[model samples]
Target: MSPSTQRITVGELAARFLEQCGVRAAFGVISIHNMPILDAFHTRQKIRFVSARGEAGACNMADAYARVSGTLGVCVTSTGTGCGNAAGAMVEAITAGTPLLHLTGQIESPFLDRDLGYIHEHPAQLAMLKSVGKDAFRIRNPETALATLREAVRLAQTPPCGPVSIEIPIDVQKMKLDLPADLSPLAVPPVQPNLAAVDQLAERLLSAKRPLLWLGGGARGASAAAQRLVKMGWAVVSSVQGRGIVPEDHPASLGSYNLQKPAEEFYETVDALLAVGTRLRSNETLNYKLKLPATRYRIDANALAHNRGYTSELFVHGDAEITLNALADRLEGRMQIDPKLAADVKRARAEAASLVDGTLGQYVKLKNTLAEVVGKNLWWVRDITLSNSMWGNRAPVLDHPRAGVHALGGGIGQGLAMGVGVAVADAEHQLGRRTVSLCGDGGFMLNVGELACAAQEKANVVFLVMNDQRYGVIKNIQDDIYGSRHAYVELHTPDFAQLCASLQVPHFKLADPATTRDTLQKALAHGNGPVVVEVDMNAWGPFAVKFAGPPKKKEEA
Candidate 1:
């Protein structure tokens, strides 16, 4: 190892690569199989490791982190059962399309799959990953490790983004890297949608009686584009994963379409469908049964370039930002918004507001309170609400980077863990901003161990636990849909504020809605170790309407 050659350990090199990728936080229960990687993380002062109580919690934390921060969330676990245990979350990350980088330590390379003496089903573990998405790979050689990770992150950032899992061996993780001193993280190319397609699509949108625009996480970095569409007389309907792409308060917004009824109505009324930056997945598009009329256009960077199964009159390969820009330029200040349509949308919003009392009302209040404290600059890292909300990302009624990997599908425990990652990523770029995470009691309890990571690393995080004393969504179904026959849903929670205090951190419990503002203000206003505002939201709870409106038929997108 020459001095000029900059010989670093493989684990350290891996950590450095992740660091360059703006990976500020991680989750895992350090195991013998991954001690080298864990040690590498410990040495890297810039990155923080959130030691989760279980592998599921670790996976969920990474998923949430990616969703919240618009960065690839990270998680690690031992081989075999560990990876299999994290499979549910891995599947979630894949389903949700969260950009999560999962690391699992495999058996030593000596045996070489001979089944010489394996303790668990290694093949089955890796098989689960391959079955989920294309973003899964094995890190076999130290020589190609950095470049491999580079490509993984790049693929993750691509439109129709999903998870990327890297299965590294214990021996491989320990090997020394004969690599460069400094390697910048690979940057994803900004997609530029064809202006002609945007113009044609815009024209189609203008002609619609009740056109619908379904957005996915592809619009995470494309907020300006959504705003422009709002101005162009489009009845924008954000998919569950596509939540927060637009400010929910926009009058033209149709809210999120995740249930059977509204989603059916969404597609039924559509004269033209603009499935922008989405894959129209089965869940988002509901197995593509919602029939879109002959008049519709699909715009996806991948779809336009390949021209595969996508049925579209016009397809554009480009970034939402670029496409929106192209559309704006093509529009030349021409908009076709109807006054009556705007009024109708407002009336509907008012009606929805009235129906959203009790538990849902508390969610609205939670959303509003956070918005008030964070204002325009703060980003809300959300997880539970994505695939199951009427508002999706658009419900918040505030302008911030509220795009989580909700659509990416990492794991349930990722909300707080991912928030730390996003917050750290922002801090590195001097993007001095506040990020708050709204994890339900189920979501919070899943990743409670991350609180210690926050305390240890002094991560400036404010985790607001919507402690509803139940898996409120399941409870909602029981109460509203199933004659109140609730079971195995409600939870008995520990004193989360005390939990934070025991971790030697600042904490508060918000019982009164009036005091919530002041309590939240204090938590958001400070920048020490992480703080927790355990909102005992006994007033309201969680429910599931639909993950997103039904996907349009093949002709739609």
Candidate 2:
């Protein structure tokens, strides 16, 4: 308890910094700039170094781990292209509102500006973070290392949790430091929901004959509140990020709803929408086509606190857990659940689900069959691809109590990596739920290097591949807009099963869709570290609704 006892090296200080974050595993490969910090920490009982096959996979695995465990997940990577390759996964963690701390090796210190012949000049990492809605900093001086570490953990774990980066220059790591570990644990102000706003929101719902409670990332820990809200009897539509925050089978919930432009009937006539946590992203709101009487009552922590004028009609500046609880309290005191409203939500949900199923029936019939065999409450992480539209529509039974994370904007090649993170989280939290992720064949190859992370760390995630030999989304666009012209989008994919085998991963190939049911069941039920079940199929259109040969007019009279 003396000042002498407090002194620790910057490397040692960094380990303690992560330990303060309550991070048990630091997943990433060791590199020159980070070797000291990573090696020193290997002996730290509170934290262990998770050796991943590649840094990107390590970062992604950490991102998912953070979301699942509610602890700041950390990953280390070498700088330059290493950091750039991490961009896709970082964007995933940010858009999904998952908390993650990424540490990347800097180009020593001298090469930062002049390039001093340092192969990797990375002065642009902070810019990258800001662009992705993440916070980042560089530690050139060992003096500020503690402060920088604290900030990274603090911001990553902040409400609307997202990724944060810290670049450690070699100089900062090896510099003889005489500083004490003044590391205070990440201190975040308790986000208390605004009761006044909750009351007003309840007022609108009390009278809304067709009110809908559309939830998203902000509703992370408010499951009980969500069930209570359903008891008040409003319809709920979930966005991609909003999908798992509430139970999919909840009677009031209308599975995961995709771009309303594609399913216009569901939202075009709603009396009111309670959009919690969702940014009302264009994809979710059909490019802001949700004709809210006015921009008044969408509840999001960021919009409410900052741009009150542009945020929501009933602004509530707090996390979803707090806001939903307050709203639940208000509803308990005020509104009586009318059987009519409950019945209406049920009818609307069933109708929408049926219409959507009919729209994409061709594809969901296949994935749902496999998902059913996989069983209820199973966690599914989707990387953006041609199959995204169909799977999002199916809202495959969430076989367990866990959240799903995906990039808000369409970004691909992250499924394998995120699975590594989520699998790590699933194991760490000791949750009994099985984890499965759907990755496009294209995405799987891009991040397949991370398979070693799963191998080395033994993350228990099963990966299912929709192995159409092309970038399916682009193929869909070219097919629709270019008269089915074959462009540069087509791929002559290598043996996908062979590819997984090369990565030392056990894989099974479904050359035909007929075997998909049994293939997925075996993969999910497999006790191996991780398995990939690749389904070979051709690319389809963008949620193509097969009409009866004729293009119907907007108003067929």
The best candidate by lDDT is 2
Q: Candidate 2, TM-score vs. the true structure? A: 0.88
> Candidate 1: lDDT over CA atoms?
0.66
lDDT of candidates 1 onward, in order: 0.66, 0.68
The alpha-carbon RMSD values of the candidates against the true structure, listed in the order shown, are 5.4, 4.0
lDDT of 2 at 231: 67
Worst lDDT 10-window in candidate 2: 546-555
Model 2 RMSD, rounded to 1 decimal: 4.0
Top-scoring candidate (TM-score): 2
Candidate 2 ranges with C-alpha deviation above 4 Å:
1-7, 110-112, 123-130, 176-182, 202-205, 258-270, 291-296, 304-312, 359-362, 399-401, 538-557
